[model samples]
Target: MRLLALDRFTWRRIYWILLVFLVILITVWWQPNRTFPTGGSLARDSANPQQVKGAIQPIPLSVDLDVEKVALGEELFRDKRLSADNQVSCLSCHHFKRGGADRQTYSVGSGGVPGDINALTVFNAGFNFRFNWNGAYETLEDQIQATLQNPKAMGSQWNEVVEELQATPEYPKLFARAYADGLTAENIKDAIATYIKSLYTPNSRFDQYLKGDEQALTPDEKAGYQLFQDYGCISCHQGMNIGGNMFQRFGVIGDYFDPKDGITQADLGYYNVTKDEADRYVFRVPSLRNVALTAPYMHNGSVETLEEMVKIVAKAQLGRTLSEGDTDLIVQFLKTLTGEYLGGSLEKLALDSDDDITS
Candidate 1:
């Protein structure tokens, strides 16, 4: 009798398990349309650009640079006094010699704290639509202010920043030459922004080819360019900088966030700022200028190699995987996008010292 009761209890438990599975199956089956991006719920092709229909026009390198403002801006760009610890400067992470990025997975900021996102290259950042991956700041001034205060970044309060700069004997004169009112926060931001504005790059091999110099790019690069457009990378990345004009989800046709990485809050990209459901997982498309130099790509600094980046982009963004040869050709094509600054050097501006500034 005890053995019979034991078997009956086990059968009851089995029945309950089956019932629960059926309920779950019904719930999931009813929500068939709610599958992930690659499952066809979201507009993958809409997010992946196909052509450079309208891109921001590239500025000619021959155009005269504003030397005074650029010089003053260059001083501030390298000034560590702008930060609280007198260590971190704009150049600390965005190294010009390294293609505007420190090439690390994450950059060390003030007090040795690390930034969550990788720094974008300053080479052609001026042409981007919105600043930062989240599109937080609209202008360069706003971005500067945010960077100065963010504890995970420069960590200096705005007032403290101004006070430190004010105490410096060399900044006022530089500010005076750059702006109508010298050394004020507004003018300080303006000068820095002006300097960054002057950091535009042009005269890349791609630009030469675009201007009708067919021989500028090699055969492999030309093939890569064709694949780049044919596979639809040009749609979003078409602009002068080859991107930065719009926002896109990191994975257009897939959920890029791997739960196995212990990820909790779905990287709710621009949606965090906009509070719109559709904006979820969206980030500002970064410029590919000097892409060959920038390593540890993406906002999270997840991907390390450019070749792997290309593969991921091809599969997730383009809804297809590229052949090894195609990827190699595409990489070759991307290499030609590196541009030259007309009259300035990123290395010089980044490594400038406080003693170099004029009062």
Candidate 2:
């Protein structure tokens, strides 16, 4: 009789579990005409982006950097000896004059091969929590190493790079000055990473405005900032670097990819790293700092102008259409993000580049 009572109790628990599961299933199930959430719920809401929280903060005026290591790294960064071919270097894709990127739709890598994705700006990259569009790398050093070994990029092995750097007349003594191990692979990476970390840009007009300098930004630029928040562009693009702290899907409201264009491996985004079906088009939110200067927007570098890209981002991600005037105001605000490159060498390079172009 006791066993019978226990069985009855077990059956009652199972019945309750089944009932709860059914209720949850019904709650989430959408009607045939009504679609479910695809991450555009915030855009659909009426709240201002600033009111919704997560407004971007100003990048600090200063950061710690290894002075000696940065000097050595800057020289190494321009050395083409790191790539398989003697023609390419880190500077090949990252030109300081062109907004810390090549300004190409897609960068031309080793052997003149076009990269599958856009070459992101290296300016203010130290502020990014993760590296790359896929966020495959958590450290700047890892990203540098990966780039060196990538078949489409440097296409060179560490042993090859080490051999070349050791052969250089200046590199040996420079590395020795910077490290006890001198020219070891790790030391090379450390020096380069140190230099890259020092590439922080600061004191943009927007940052000045953020710091309570009300007169720093023009009236149109201020209005653009408001529209940027109101249009929900600020939802993903917030925090110190403006947008590098999180990952989000490329097209939340509508499909951004054309299957006919032949989706390449780069288009897979975070899926390439995790192999998760849910991560199909997930990407690290890129920093909007210096974005006005970096043209050919999007991962594929398909969008041409800042105005067009703004509209595309609004429609594709937020499921909203913006007027031309609204986009124009936002562009004006974005122009204020082009800050001074604090590194003297980079600033000189920009000036020299301009001089060379005009001469």
Candidate 3:
């Protein structure tokens, strides 16, 4: 009887050990891998094993980049010589203080020509899986090339831009410092792209909440976040940039474009690139970071306010009519997403003359 009791106790101990091992394995597997641009891993919360993980992840506090390249890039970004008319620069549409985008419905390009679609924010653009409203370019380099050649945009030939920059005394020295093979077209693009990559805004209130701060969000904001998930907004708008990781049909539940208003070529979306009928009206989901500050939303920029955009998107995308109270809550939650850039709040740093465009 003594031997049998001892055997039973040993078996019970083995069973408990196996169960504990399984729990640890599952927890590790379930945890999402959060990595910084510099390839560093973010720390996990091991103490609260029971804490539920959300789909959205926080942006890294900082990125590792060459300061010289960043400076050169910034100089190139603001230089008007890249344009055919010498009146427009990258900053013409992508204003740093205006949420990295202009308040204009359709950004004016070279010679005051209006673009077909709205300009997406340059801030946190590095996190996007694809670039532009149509996901036309996979890399920023490719997009920059297209922009340089676009008649309505920069409207300058690569050869012309190279010649113009090479003639400049300051650019030659800047290029020499930033690149080994300096004053080349490729090097110029690389410098500008690197500078744009450094524009990530982190440490938003929502990010603080994600990093284990229980009081970072108010009760109403928490409820709004819950509603955001419940209403399936989290479906396409998941991951680090909140929405830039995937592409989805703008009108998932119903046709968004009105027959009376007529559909333009821009409304065709990715279909214009692939000529695929199935891809019609499909667009890359834009990042919601600093969304409150970037107004006149959507591809055509028809919607002027965040409130109206939310109402239209919920009905058109999810096929659900959100109550006024719920909409207010969601908007409040979105407001918390405005992050800090250069250790200052984007709200405070925004340009007072958001609508005025000198270029």
Candidate 4:
């Protein structure tokens, strides 16, 4: 009887091990695009790739730029006088070396006040028809003025900023050279706006591939692009900037925010601008150029790695939870979007690997 009992117990243990192995095998087999694109180009393999073609357009390598205006804007963007305490400038939040973003969910501004929302990249500001996450300002100059006046940002009115610049002898001559109107508040906005517009980045590997350079991207990257399109990421994130073209509701398939998690007024999104119920949670889509270089993704900057961000976006926007291997494959494609900085090269920016995104 003892011998019979031992044999039964051993068989039970073997049965359990086989069950576990089968589960893993079935899981892998069930999920399509587990490690790469299922087959061919997205257009050929996908049921409707032509419909997606208009959703995303490639960026050009370069654009006609005004060198003088961009130079002045670059200087003013770094000069701390734009802030009330002379302690903050645009560069404080948007670092050139850091994909034109501070990588902070909430950036500190004038008077050491933390900004309410995440700072968006200024790298491709010119491509967007509207500015700011809420599309609050229609033009970059308007956005500049809002920043200069917002207490949490520059924290000063135009008169004080203009007066300070007028007293500075060097600024007067620089302004005169850039604009016929010279160093007035309007001209300041114009020159700075011109410069900000010139901050466009291009010549990424993906762009080269779009320009008919077949070898610009690797096999994995190409698969990722195919998955990117197949998964409907191209729906909102299209156009020259790969996003920043229109507004979309934050949680299309699922509610992403909870007031219990310390939600603030900024979370209300375009509702704050229009005061309409339908406008709630509507925000301008951010550009994906240099996305690999810019970490801590999302408007809140809450998501950590690119893989995790893709999963969250898939769930919230498309109502799908991707397999781990599929997520990694899509991330491989996004890395190809990192491009050369306009007028210079961009070093791969550091990521905040310590982010706690368990929630």
Candidate 5:
């Protein structure tokens, strides 16, 4: 009996020792292999293909979509008849030449009324987990419907919009080609959203660097990218879209709004939607893709220059004061994010006038 007891104790001790060893092994393995939220697996270094690093992934060059739907949707996107006054269209605010956003602090709405918030870029918007600054809509279709009905936007009833489109000589034919349903409100919204999804701008220099092109980025820009990761900017902005994957408070470290300026309803952010006090000033993190072309910055468009915006965001969000030299380097890295759209660089397209754009 004594010998049997001794054997039992010895076996139990060995089992516990193995269990502890397994736990340690797992901890060590997971620590290195674990991925950040929305970040891709570590990529190989451009210079040394064997060395793995980086979290950001390249945007896909193209997405498969129905060509007929895309063509019909593009027409609707530019059509003024969708608005109540027949003066505003989606393109009025989302300009292809201007990085898919109008370069205005507040977009001029249908009757010359300014909007409550800055217009986010339409390019790469489909990559976002949710739509709008407050995340009020879950799907692109929902956002489109709301925008159409919103008094400050298109301001048109769905019935009227459908009727007008059905009456238009070209729209019926376009709708028939895109959908068998032909000119329903649902089909119209779907077509428009489909086209918006096709607006992704890919093949940026940064994407080339990610895909193992050593010469894509300058030495300073590469250093800036390293600094971006080291400084924890990647925590919220480390996805294919570089942002738009998460919601974060505008000011994580300190108060960003001025008391004297007075808070508007728009400043309430998700709080207006949820009516929860905790949600105040919380917003969907805007994508940094093509950010250099779409300025002024922030939800309110308070910061005019990209450099000034970077300084403000660093101080408010990261609680760090960046040196002038560091700021310049980071800005240079950001500029490399501007990508190709419609077989042309967005920077080159921005120089084209509205007339040229329509032509």
Candidate 6:
């Protein structure tokens, strides 16, 4: 009688159990379909994983830039008066003549203190999804504010800087031209951001080559380009600027953590902002534009030479070792990405000297 009663109880719960099973089974079976474009050169066998699955269609570059903002942005970019000291301008670290970089392992800030990482070039930074090596700032304006306020960088508080600017006669007029209101922290940030957005250098030899100008790249450069794609460098380093669109870990193939090296406190990369464990050591991939001039590669400025950078990349990303010759070719190809600054007449903003300020 007890067995008969237990059988009935089992049968009563059978429908409930089946319903739960079906829900779980459906969830397991249904995978969301995602799509992306195949990237890199037509001559090479380059295709994204999405392309392999035939879930995405290829799309060409299509977007018009605001020329007025870019023109105004160029002027504001060269203005040294943006800094409290007037000695440390945006161009001070990213000089136009020097391939938009200081070429130092680390940049010297206002008080002669070194920044943690090598200063990235300003060129095509607008193309990046996020700003900074660790992907800390979301926009150029945000980075500008952080840079200005950081004691190591500009070493000036917002209120004090504003008061100084208010005292200056030209700043009020410049602010009027740039923005309607005279000078505020928010407006200053917006104006600076507006100028940075205009700093794109789209036309390059590689761009011409992509547009079917076969002679744009030399024979060696063409070979190097092929090797770059074939060797799987383009998997992460792709898109309009060759890189700077995504984030990846420092040591993907090998464990970056060395207990002996005292690399305590997990870097956590974008995770600090998002709180995702997957973002550890991941950073915004830098633009290859003016790459030849921007030395001391990587987030911590670890790899000094481009050849070492290539080797490290090959080992960490590709999971393969690269020859010295192969590294040289890759470096040579990178050199082609350097574009000339179009803005010739960047007016440097003048500030009153100590005598002028007091007088």
Compose the digit string of candidate 2's lDDT tens values, residues 1-359: 99999999999999999999999888777433143223555555327433445368887878788899999989988888888887788987887887888777788778776688898988889889899998999999999989998867788899989998888899899888989888998988888888888887888888889899999999999999888777777767878888888888888887787799889888889999999998888899899998887888988889899999999888888887889899899999888887877634333455464444210
Top-down lDDT ranking: 3, 5, 2, 4, 1, 6
Q: What's the lDDT for all of these models?
A: 0.75, 0.82, 0.84, 0.80, 0.84, 0.66
Maximum-TM-score candidate: 5
Clashing pairs for model 6 are 73-195
Q: Write the per-residue lDDT of candidate 5 for residues 168-248, one digit (tens) a residue.
A: 889998888778878899999999999999999999999999999989999999988876665556667757888887777
lDDT per residue as tens, model 3, 184-268: 9899889988988999999999999999998999999998887776666766677899888877778877788776899989888
* RMSD (CA, angstroms), candidate 3: 8.0
Worst 10 residues of 2 by lDDT: 30-39
**Each prediction's Cα RMSD?**
15.0, 6.6, 8.0, 19.2, 4.9, 8.6
* TM-score of every candidate relative to the true structure: 0.79, 0.84, 0.84, 0.82, 0.86, 0.75
Worst 10 residues of 6 by lDDT: 345-354
Tell me the spans in candidate 5 whose CA falls farther than 4 Å from its real position. 1-54, 354-359
Higher-scoring candidate on lDDT, 2 or 4: 2
Q: Whole-model lDDT for model 4 versus the true structure?
A: 0.80
The segments of candidate 1 whose C-alpha lies over 4 angstroms from its true place after superposition are 1-59, 62-65, 264-266, 343-359
Of the two candidates 3 and 6, the one with more favorable lDDT, higher being better, is 3
Cα miss at 114, model 3 (Å)? Answer: 1.9
Off by over 4 Å in 2: 1-54, 343-359
Candidate 6 local lDDT, 1-359, one digit each (tens) = 99999999998799789999999999878844221112223123344444222211111233355454445455555666666677777777776544566666677787676676677877678777788877788888899889887755676687877777788866677666666666788877776677676566654566667667899899888888777876767656777666777777766777665667655232456666677787766766666766766677866566788888888877776677898888888888887775544533111111112232210
- CA lDDT of 55 in candidate 6? 18
Please tell me which model should have the higher lDDT, number 2 or number 3: 3
Give the better candidate number (1 or 6) by TM-score. Answer: 1
Clashes of 2: 0
